[model samples]
Target chain A: MPVTENIYEPVKAKLTNIIDESPLIKTLVLVPEKEFSFKTGEFIELTLNGIGEAPFTPSSSPLVKDKLEITVMKAGYVTGKIHQLNIGDVVGIRGPFGKGYPLEKFYGKEVLIVGGGCGFAPIRSLLYKLIAEKEKFKKVIFCYGSKTPKDCIYKTLFKELRNIEKFQVLRSVDMADEPWDETIGVVTVLLDQIKIDINNSLAIVCGPPVMMKFGTIRLLEMGYRETDIYLSMEKNMSCGLGKCGHCMLGDYLVCKDGPVFTYNEIKGLPDIWR
Target chain B: MEITVESLKKITFFKEFDSVTIEKILKISELQEFDVEEKIFDEHQKLIDIFVLLEGKVILGINVPGKGKINLGTIHPGQLFSWSALFPPSISTAYAFADVPVKVLSIKASKIQELVGDNDTFGYKFMKIIGQTLSKRLSDTRFQLINMASV
Candidate 1:
């Protein structure tokens, strides 16, 4: 593959809309000056000009080239600053780094998606791809968990997903508040309630560290193969390119080689869940 | 609701039990239903029957002095609740209520105790399942505690 000459340069993008997902998370819609396309699970470096840049997986569908959507959680200084920006502010976007979810491998198989918190961002993108090519897969099961009902992002998307044929959306809140009618437990518990043929299914997990660890363990117990379990790992990725050692997971660079990897690929790596 | 061995076999908790054992358990169990928000048991209340959720959701909570009812976890179908009845003291650890219209297989704790005492194999298998359930709940509670502390 040929590399782009201006790998360091960023294309300008105008923030078009902001959707307040939760108290601490927001989804920013941006219209890039140039058509930008990325695969479902790829990560992009979003620069706030002089403030700083952070890596985020686009929450919008990869098919939408004219614009991108990034879901942001107010976790640190850069994100806190990003949260303060209003509509019409311009931001810089660099490379659509890392290998993405392999859509072809998922064809003719059941797709099980387990996500929590802001991890729903990338999974949402993948969901869009799956929905567009719904005939390719046998079934899709999404199990999501949040701290509470108020903390759940993409609340409206669940209803939309449920309407799609061969798609099942199940949600759980670690704690419950009034007017909430769904399962209440950790996200892994949803695994028990779902009936899937483990042999013909692919399990995808993206979440906070603790959840990712436990969710993987639960999937393993449910008879999912290590090679069939894919995890979206988040690391301190300073550079979207592999040159920066900031995002190294064992010998692999999370930014370049993967933000998406099968459990078989990373199980031996130390502190992967963290 | 009619209680059948076949239906009991469908539940994860009873799946390992033989038909004869399920029949024995069925003799000591009956189907019970609760309306939405109906309190099934309170913390410190003497538990007489252990329940396997047949359908709907159950919210387990603890009553704090000022916080009132603080829901800690949810019980899903095919899962067991109120295992305190199987142990000594037989008092509930947390209060449980119907999060929705709920159905459960209520098993008489004393009869289960009698069955366990009489059969060593049945006792071992039953205890093993209970142990697994407790282990899972412990991990879940630890996860919830970490989540609360972080928040």
Candidate 2:
């Protein structure tokens, strides 16, 4: 079903800071006047008036309600304009649309979160949520990859997340050069370093098309059932409410049917980017 | 893991075919490759074999008089297309082109008929797969038509 509603709620947030995640990507942390509550995998449509708007996942912990955060990669027109916005700038906020990861399922279950490049945003949110309630989950393993260390968003957060007692953070770069000492290759390669109890664990994947394609297959090979693999899809989501058809992945609309879907639910959908 | 006849036979539609029969069927099918932007099957072309896309994207297009080229839909991996010749009239109504470099396996229509003639069970299973393909394409066409009408 298409999302027929567009509830425009005004939110005033002071852009506390902007961290340059990479040359083309940045994270905007906003301390809103009021609390902004959202699930990790859900997204918000940020409006920039004349420049248009784009959909992004607020990568802040669900536990933190007074602040909002979004990691954005500068890809084309709208995101380019978004990159120009500075701290203290006011931006339009439209939604906390689409359901987040099945956090309830992860309770008492080991979870694997895999991501690549700027695709790491939503995965990071999932990671944070799991970490906030660490006692609930058995273990959390995060595997992330990017073209280079320079292009890795949330590069700093990796160190902090690794320091967490219950979390295992592994990172890789496609091609390594400058002073890099870590795993290298596609994100799937890191799957080798981490052990997954596929039967008892859930895998949440969000990344570029190529990354998810192989990641899903690898997870399946590791004995994870198709139903247990949750994929975060990326599409041209203009209206987070699913009014816009830009995010159509077969009969299902990515904005509504999912930004997050179980592999079994979407394996039959045609033209799935991942 | 091995895509052998045994594995093929496990698919619901291929359940009728035993290991030996499925092996024979695979022999008749040949892998074909198409370069990026290459035409796989043109509209009105006679269908000789059933094309199963194993990889890459295929663009299904139709020409409209007094208008221009219209993209009906696009097919990705695991999806099948160009089945127009499988039914009445036995001629393609739309063209199929490789939007990107593609790899596919083709089973000759004549060979399919032969296999079906020999084994009704195999025939029924094969027809089921074809029927599913046709149903999906019909729905996709309807969606395109609706989008066009709205335009």
Candidate 3:
């Protein structure tokens, strides 16, 4: 957030807090030294001094520039280093690269969001954007799935989101041991349990490949046209710019053309996504 | 070939998890149907859930760009497709396609996490199930790589 001299400006983003989404996933809330603007679905590259960088969405809405949040899971090398930073640690940040969700398209329609694991990060940003224009959409339903009750990231705030008048939330897991009150199955299974008007709705899904694959298949089966389904893809997106082929899925570069793509645009691509 | 809990109990990974726990996993996991020669998991796909071979076989493949797809190994019953789903936002390391009419016990990753959260003991037992599958396939992959090099 701090404006400095070089391309690799050392912006002192003070980690305001960390929200544990799950055992290995946490949302790091930071207060930038300066205001940084980004779209609802755009991403910023977070760099740890010695480690490296990874692309992540500012889970916080663009409307709120004073504070920004990037949800990270302790996964690979760079991300594992990100988890090591404490509140008040300084981490370098770059532009809010990539396009965001098409808020204009869902201006007056029902929107269904299906997110899984860390995939919830970008959707959280989109949700915050939609909440600003809550009246624009008739209804918004979030079907989020995590591995366990404890494995479920954002378990605490999800209840608050559920309280939103225009929102309906359902949390599910594939397997439960002792006892779980919520639905127990894949997040796609939540589709069968809910009533959706595919003709008048748009579906946004972000998650692992299998979930997205099956979720998209079920949505298509339920009459949700390919164009109506939007997906946020994940790969080892090293460079936020298209120059690096790390995030290329097909003809499209995830860093440039997407992070968010319509199902129709990517349907012809092998394996359903990039 | 059909595989039941009764048959699985004969394996070491299924030994600790009782019939009930196995039944629960079996009940929650769906059987994915795939056609022969159809890709089950493509290289571009995001890796989320892991697959357990229930019937028939699958080929773990890598796209060599210039040489087309190179078969890493074949997945058989008691083997897995992608165990990386245990970690979130996992990238699919390879392409998985059906070698024959295949049915796999497709377990949603969230369920695996929930089970682990509710009971680590239960989760560890299940991890063992996949871990054994992984080890077996890893050795198989080593063999395949050796064969490829030899040629």
Number of the top lDDT candidate = 1
Fnat for every candidate: 0.54, 0.00, 0.00
TM-scores of the models, in the given order?
A: 0.97, 0.62, 0.63
Candidate 1 lDDT at A131 equals 98
* Stretches of candidate 1 exceeding 4 Å from the true structure: A1-4
DockQ scores of all models, one per candidate = 0.67, 0.02, 0.02
Per-residue CA lDDT of model 2 for B1-151, tens digit only, reads 2356765554444455578777877888887889987988888888887776666767666676875664545555555566665665668888887877888767777777888789887778778878866764554344334323422
TM-score-based ranking: 1, 3, 2
Interface RMSD of each: 1.4, 16.9, 15.7
Candidate 2 residue pairs that clash: none
lDDT order, best first, reads 1, 3, 2
| Best prediction by DockQ | 1
Weakest 10 consecutive residues, lDDT, candidate 1 chain A? A1-10
Indicate the DockQ of the complex predicted as candidate 1: 0.67
Q: Give the B-chain TM-score of model 1.
A: 0.96
- Place model 2 in a CAPRI quality band: incorrect
- Which number leads on TM-score? 1
Residues A137-203, candidate 3: write the lDDT tens digits: 9899999876555677766668889889899998876533324556544576567447677789999
Distance from true location, Cα of A10 in model 3, Å: 5.5
With a 3 Å backbone cut-off (N, CA, C), the pairs that clash in candidate 3 are A21-A153, A147-B110, A147-B113, A147-B114, A148-B114, A174-B111, A175-B111, A209-B46
Off by over 4 Å in 2: A1-6, B1-151
Give a tens-digit lDDT track for model 2, residues A105-215. 889998898887778888777777787899999989999877766887877788999899889988866544333456545576577557667778999898877677777
